[model samples]
Target: MGYRFHPRSRTIKMDDWIFSPVLQRTYASTEAHYLLLRHLFEGQPIAYCRVSATCNSLNVKARQYHEQMGYKYEGTFRKDNIARWGTPRDSACSSMLDDEWPLNKSVLLTYLLATNFDADGKQIRSLQELRTLQTRCSL
Candidate 1:
């Protein structure tokens, strides 16, 4: 666990984002990874973390887990739920965006592209080679 201080409010934010993953099964600690990715793109300072969303029909285990993480309902997505399942599922939704945005993702997705491989090891060849690979040369 670690903490970061805000310059203006002099507020102290404690975060275990990295370690959160290890303790995720208890709550959203497991799902925090996805949030981390989202936060990376949003580029905000995250003081707290969790790994679940109450927006869908998550299992009871997940619901309890999220509750333990200190996330309160911000709003309900009653319309979206009714538009789909309606009374059948009685599916309403909620969120916990208490702050505008938090967390930074200076290092997020790192994809290794075909554009960076050599002729010997890379499958990305010219259009002609692609056709050849599609068909077998064997009789």
Candidate 2:
């Protein structure tokens, strides 16, 4: 993971947010990501946080994940970068503004604090379900 501060815009450009295979399918990565986001929100003067994911098969999965994490898909930068194999790659961008942080933070906290799992550790209410409920209540 990486970020750059834009002093003029008061924004944090989140970059290269990816996890290892071992952490995949677990809440560890999500939890860690949220914690970091909370830290930034609390400790920084950031007005906007932006994240980008590539259009490749692996990174493409993050588009929905970013939405679940409270980011709104802005647009894709076509042929923004060249891949290791020399092919052009597209980058999908998303952002969360300061005004949206509270709701997103609440949704994240709800998922983190909820008793959504049973004895066997199977989830009763997924993040998506919790997010849906949170959205409805927020409205």
Candidate 3:
């Protein structure tokens, strides 16, 4: 679901993280991705993590999801690859720096807590809502 690279450098590149369509909106993907990040960054020397997604209709939601997870968009790599259909596809790149990880980690942890959900399993507050509130409080 996720990966860590660059043992010598304080950086990791996450590649090929995908979840089945049935798992969407269930928080499985988000939790798994966060766990990978927590494992790599907790008490480790990692400082940056980069992730990229293909620029296509299918991946538009993925890019937005990455942003929701606190990744900052760097730019797009034009014609980064040729799809299996022989169509040129761009890649959107994003990264999360060490300085920004702590807050993100906190937000994720808070969001994942049982108290954040209701009896019906609906979220008491959305991730963005928590992030916004935490960011404002930290200032």
- lDDT by residue for model 2 over 29-133, one digit each (tens)? 778978877776665554444433333433767787787788888888887767669988777778877677788888777777637657765667777887789
Q: Best by lDDT, which number?
A: 3
Model 3 is weakest, by summed lDDT over 10 consecutive residues, at: 48-57
Better of 1 and 3 by TM-score: 3
Tens-place lDDT per residue, model 3, 3-93, is 5566666566664456788877666767887886676666445434433333443477878887888877887778766766999887777
Model 1 TM-score relative to the real fold: 0.29
Query: What's the TM-score of every candidate structure?
Result: 0.29, 0.83, 0.83
Backbone clash pairs for candidate 1 read 24-29, 24-30, 28-51, 40-105, 44-103, 45-103, 46-103
Superior candidate under lDDT, 1 versus 2: 2
Give the distance in Å from residue 12's predicted Cα in candidate 2 to where it truly belongs.
Answer: 1.6
Expressed as tens digits, the lDDT of each residue in 47-117 for candidate 1 is 33322244334335444433333334443344333323445332222233424122112111111234523
Clashes in model 2: which pairs? none
List where candidate 3 sits over 4 angstroms from the true fold: 1-4, 43-58
User: What is the number of backbone collisions in each predicted candidate, taken in the order shown?
Assistant: 7, 0, 0
**Candidate 1 global CA lDDT score:** 0.35
